[model samples]
Target: MVMSLALISSCQWKKKSSKAMRRRRGGAPEIHLDLLIEILTRLPGRSLMRFKCVSKLWFSLIRSRCFSNHYLTVASPPRPPRRLYMSLVDHLECNSMAVCYNPRESALLLFTSSSSSSNNATSFDQDLTLPGMGGRNMKLLRGLILYIVCRRACIYNPTTRQSVTLPAVKSNIFAQEDYRKSVLYFFGHDPVLDQYKVVCIIVVSSKKIKRITSEHWVFVLEPGGSWKRIELDQPHIPTRLGLCINGVIYYLASTCMSDDIIVSFDVRSEEFKMIQGPPLVSAFKPIDFIEYGGKPSVFDHTRLRRKGLVELWVLEDAGEWSRKSLVLQPCQMHLVNKYTKWKVKGTTHNGEIIFAPLLLCSPYYILLYDVQKNDLRKVRIRGIPKHWFRKPDTNLFFYFEFMDDSESIMHLEI
Candidate 1:
């Protein structure tokens, strides 16, 4: 009887142990989907993109509306922002004309003020081989690099590492009749309509001076269609073509011997209209025209007593122009032993006018003009060594673009 009782007790203990083992080996408790989403939403965009491969649960959590909205809201900061700085790798010149950014590191480092020169710069090192000229007339726009090589135009996205080769435009429109003159190429995009266009303006010899003849071609990338030529009723040649803003392409054209006119091309309507510019002397010619803060502006550099005097003109209204001259002190002008040539390249970003003074000098620098306060600040970057111009790294280049205010700082959802 005692032996039977012991066996029964032993069987009860065995049943309890078997129950505990089943609990440990069988299905684990399920994680609440909402809690899992909250954890994944904090990951950076680059990491989030990779996390999609983990499992279907994680992918769905990342792609959900609630998580995406929260991720974007928490990621980017509020804006009425000023300047944005982007860093290019050392190999920017050889491998590609543009440098690709790692999405995780692209968060905007905003500045409190336009003049604030804090640590607002960022760097990129990934190399991309774009199909075109190795390096000439390269401009960064809307995550795409626009470049030209041997009269062929190309638009490449460094992030995607995808390139689209534009077909050769008819040479007659840009080719010279005398075969001695050189053709000039200009390209820009219409962001509103999502269209990219290239303008080829050729200078041909007339009587004693050169004359301008231009052809405008538009490239629609939505459906990957052929180039469409736009007809201009008049024969006005453009000196420079600025990017399209608000559905209009602004061109700086010299209509007369003594004046430069601001011309606007309506991409949707395919029509041309002209805006009057400030009066100019017979010898004065327009050197550069760029869009600043959504308005057309012009820059002119000329010799005054064997010194360079740069003047900036901003369009106030349809026919009004405001002129601000940057008087480079005698000491500021460096002498070029070679051709005695000095050129000023200017562009606008984040409501400020930035100009680079290029000459054969010991110190090469860039000048920033604050349009709001009408102030000037000279910024010098200390990387290029002496004799650097002769053996230019060909690898060093600058990339500029407007930051997307909506998604500038959003965190990546995984």
Candidate 2:
């Protein structure tokens, strides 16, 4: 009887194994190219990039013009209401948390507590950790984060846990001393060419008033090949690196002690040309680059007798830089004065310009300036001691970088 039971179990196991093999042979259902693209479009950018390696059909589909147009159309729709976060250092230096908030939610609550004297500090959310982040200059480009650490750069998609490290750049071309000089890094995606480009500026510093040197590097993210660095005639050192609007990277350069010049880099042709800025006002603060109304815009600040005012400029014509609209309004100087010196920290998704007031201020407050409607709001985290922004305990220093979600995906797509 025992032998009979054992034989019966063995036969059952063999039958199960045979069924598994049959299923394996049957394989997954064949998905048509259009159907595959529809499903692929639903997946995040990083997943599509990985799917390229799955099969030659997938590679052709993803790299096709129709796929790119559809991807951009679906991925970059009308801006959703977003929440911004800034990291706060806890007792452990390495362990930090971030506070975030959705401005739309805040607006709903504002009407209920309309008479409240408190400056709507409750809009800010609780703490979140800065996980999987290494020291780097990060930029948000089209729903992905681009992080640059040392000589290496990567595109990280936090939502999908997908990251692609770019190939190491050739360090031998630039001298060690030249590398130490102030350099501007800009990352962007050009759908026209279906490629990603990382632009690096190597500026020559001089203590003398009239002396200047121009040195720079351009690295293209080619398909299959590693990042190829292209040498170019050096333009002036750009004060601020702009985003890619229509296949070009715009930069604001200080032409003279008093003049500011807008320069642009063509990703396809690898050329540099100058654009126009706003009309000059006495004591004009340099314009900060931002994305507004689906195009590249600039935020210019001017203080009239300690009262701060700001203006937004949008590019009306790609060929004619002079064609721009200036929208102006008074700025909240109280919020601006919280930091030691106010600089355009960065721009946010909701057409708000974030200003980092103090260079050394810790537990920093992100000042949000709405260029379209002329409004100012401050985002500060709770439970943070005021002393964090005070002078450091020692002479130690720390650097802060803001990473965007869009640019991160573009790297992996490259």
Candidate 3:
């Protein structure tokens, strides 16, 4: 509806601007370029994409990087009626959970819910389907989603329904039959360059665990893009999914000397730096990365269900961390069940932490905990596919992600 109004307004403005130009001596445009851009920015992506055919000028303007940045800046603010984006990959059989689930066999469902004025109920509607099994390892940034499909790194734009599969990185570790090898891929966008990049790390180790070697590769997402080898001085094993804040990609890794370390890579500079991680870092810890108050934070809810204790670790500087502990209030303690495992999915614009169950079930609901008010409430999600819950004995696993903003209309290059 907003797009329709914007289109109507544009048509009316053009007629008035043309007459004013004729009356002027120099035939100058009555509408300033900035004003035109402001009107176009208000329209959603689908309408703007269709409007590109109206004229060459409109096509070029909408495709420019400067315009994309301007549109993002205008649309990124936290307004009311925020949305929650979720992706679920369901494995129906118990045997599928024991092994690597094939993307062809499983179902990947997308959903979105808008927050009501009362913040009481949220109803999700099914979204576009993609060719991948999204899980906890998947990462969503800006208007794109990054996931692995058949061992290939894939970046998908939900707005455009466009996907780009990155070229495979060549490594000798894959051919080494006697040695164990693992690969990790991270997705990030460079704000300065206005480009998307994928970072690949391959770690190879033997049974002795004495020697470890790794390789790093980087790929820029654009036309005629290819993977290039990069260098890192110290070899470490990445333990978790990468989190990109601003233009830096951060993830947990362990070196030969210490088990807790944070490796940060600058997307624009392509430089790697290591920071001393918090003392609570561990391979088995139940923690998630989130943007809290415009800074990178580690949400540690390992004991939230078991003991009702939650820890927030904020990165203050290079190697400094500020920690705060919050325990669940006695009255709201009933909301948590010790038997049901929960994970910190993400945060709302108002700084509320959303908690989701690890196991999938019918009548899906999520918990919202406001740090400021020290309150907890459950918001039930309606409109999940009925077929998913038809068979009670069927095993299912779900992967969910949330963004506390509206849909992005940014066009992707690849």
Candidate 4:
């Protein structure tokens, strides 16, 4: 009986050894390319980026534009996952005077969090850090974040940790005249043409005539990208950052006659349309122009903490306006401090408007208000460096955006 058991064990060992030898000798079972691609599309972007080194074929596949688009479609669902992107800058205090001491030493951290619902508490994971960039006024569109670094436009891909800097706009007016000039960049994606473009506006104001002259330039985000000049009949001063929705870039602007208007730019057609701005939206300097329920909506929360009610204006159609008032619950009113200033960062995919503090504090937290249910809650932000809170003389300046999870492995050029 013992000799029989020994023989059986030897046979089993030899069978397993033979299978291993076959795998080592390139006799492993083959998987179809399509099947492999399908399996890879379901993985997270970080994993797929690391898998690029598995083989030459994988490197090409993972980096291809086709694969990137497919992966985006697979990863993006109807509701999509929610992520928060933050750009923070620290200023040092010298003898009670606050100043940006060192741009190189300042930290620009991007944090990402995944949550199924907007009400649940979400924890952030520190994803990427760019030292000295000092990103300002960041705009996110289709998995790419556009920001300004020293007045130069930069597009960053968080998934692949890659960034591309666009050429600065050359202003002939600034070189020749003594006019005060400012440059602003707006990023948008054309769904019809499937292209990303940056709109650069240079506004030159002459005190002599009290006139403002503006020039518009467009640059597509592709290989060999160059700025092309576009003409506009009226020169308007942009008052806030551009909000792009459905291939249209919208922003509040003031005409040369001091009339406030909403300027809409078509990303694909490269055309500009002027719409008369609503009174409340134009009068408020810190008003938030956000996308609410798939339309361009103006969110006025200035009297939220004081009166416990907020006003929302939606652009129903061409030049048509609709307004609604949302009153917060009496129970949740404690979360808001009547003295502290709060700004509407953006909206979640579920249509909940997110409000964040304008001033930075040690334990940072954001509030979410559900217009439909009249519910409000706060979510605490974590993962900030302890030293930031420890230093009493440092002032933190930051901008945050809550967006759908749209990670991509796409490569950037030009």
Better of 2 and 3 by lDDT: 3
> How many clashes in each structure?
8, 12, 0, 0
lDDT rank order: 4, 3, 2, 1
Residue range 60-137, candidate 2, lDDT tens digits = 766675665566555432222233433322121221112122212111100011121134442322122233342234
Highest lDDT: give the candidate number. 4
- Per-residue lDDT tens digits for candidate 3, residues 1-414, read 555655654554443445656677455444566777887887666667778766667778888878876776676223224456565555432211123566644556455533432467676654434435354356777767777644557776665566677777766666555355677889888988888899999887665546668899999887788888888879888877787888999888777677677889999999999988777666457887776776677778888887788888888855589988898998888899887778877777688888988766778888998876778999887766667666343445555566535455556664
Model 3 worst lDDT window (10 residues): 90-99
User: Which stretches of candidate 1 lie above 4 Å from their native place?
Assistant: 1-134, 173-176, 179-192, 199-212, 255-259, 281-287, 301-311, 323-342, 360-363, 382-388, 392-414
Output the lDDT of residue 294, model 1: 70
User: In what order do the candidates fall by TM-score, top score first?
Assistant: 4, 3, 2, 1
Q: Is candidate 2 or 4 superior in lDDT? A: 4
- The alpha-carbon lDDT assigned to residue 11 of candidate 3 equals 56
lDDT score at residue 143, model 2, on the 0-100 scale: 52
Q: What's the true lDDT of residue 414 in model 3?
A: 48
- How many clashes (backbone atoms < 3 Å, residues ≥3 apart in a chain or on different chains) does model 4 have? 0
The alpha-carbon deviation from the true structure for residue 145 of candidate 2, after best TM-score superposition, in angstroms, is: 2.3
Candidate 3 residue runs with Cα over 4 Å from true position: 1-32, 76-81, 90-105, 113-118, 127-136, 178-180, 206-211, 389-397, 404-406
Tell me the lDDT of model 3 at 196.
85
